[model samples]
Target: MLTRTAIYEGTIRDGREEEFFRRVREELEPLWRRFPGVTAVRVQRMQARDEDARPIAMILEMDFPDQATIDACLASPIRPESHAATVEVMKLFDGRFYHLVGAATVLAPAA
Candidate 1:
């Protein structure tokens, strides 16, 4: 499987934290779910990290069967639509967003 993860490192605009998450759940999540070949969408909320670490408010993980699926989704017509939604959602944050794409590994216990 392939997993594309986005670690959103930023701060919610003052008085916007509640609204920010609302849009993320209501607006942005659906876009990620509808992406072609996306098998699953997982959203993680972070509480706290090290004292001197970048504050990552949230993490998004979208899983696909393979890289081909991800590439197809990226090239699909919905790309522009998703981009627009991303732009709107990002307006709630104070810093930049980042992403990484890689193969997912699931380790099983040895018998």
Candidate 2:
């Protein structure tokens, strides 16, 4: 499986955190899920970090079966729609795409 992760690595614009998350939950999520070959979607809101670390406002993860599926989804018409939806909430963020990788580990719960 291949995962495309968009790490929203920044701070929320002044006084816009709640509105941002709300828009993401209500508007952007639906559009994000509309992409083809999207197996799973997750959004993470960052709570804390190190003193010198870049504050990550959010993290979005989309899983696909392979690279081709991800590429196709990126090329699809829905991508523009997704981008538009993103802009609505993007006013609350001030970061960039952190990284895109093919391998990741899932940690199991400790007994």
Candidate 3:
């Protein structure tokens, strides 16, 4: 399995925390679930972090069967639509987002 993760590095604009998350759940998540060939979608909101660590407001993980599916999803018409939606959602945030793609490794627990 391949997982693509988006790291949202920054803070939500002051006084907009509640509204920010509300918009994510109400707006962005629906569009994310529509990505072609996506097997799963996971969203995480940061609660606490080490003092020295960079501020990460949230993390988004999308699972795909393989690179080809990822490519197709990225090339799909949803890309532009999602991008525009994301830009609207990001207006409440004061940071940047970056993505990482990696092969998933799951280890079995010892019996």
The candidate maximizing TM-score is 3
* Best model number under lDDT: 3
Q: Is candidate 1 or candidate 2 better by lDDT?
A: 1
What overall lDDT, based on C-alpha atoms, would model 2 receive against the true structure?
0.84
- What are the models' TM-scores? 0.90, 0.86, 0.95
Clashes of each: 0, 0, 0
Q: lDDT of all predictions, in order shown? A: 0.89, 0.84, 0.95
Q: Please write out the lDDT profile of model 1 over residues 49-99, one tens digit for every residue.
A: 999998898999999998889889999988798889888988989987888
lDDT of 2 by residue, 1-111 (tens): 888889887778888889989999999999888999999998988877889987778889999998889889989999998888787678677776564857577899998
Ranking of all candidate structures by their lDDT, best first: 3, 1, 2
True-vs-predicted CA distance for residue 107, candidate 1, Å: 3.1
Q: What are the per-residue Cα lDDT tens digits for candidate 3 across 1-111? A: 999999999999999999999999998899999999999999999999999999999999999999999999999999898889889989999999999999967989999
Scored against the true structure, residue 111 in model 2 reaches a CA lDDT of 88
Which model, 2 or 3, shows the larger lDDT? 3
Candidate 3 Cα outliers beyond 4 Å, as residue runs: 109-111
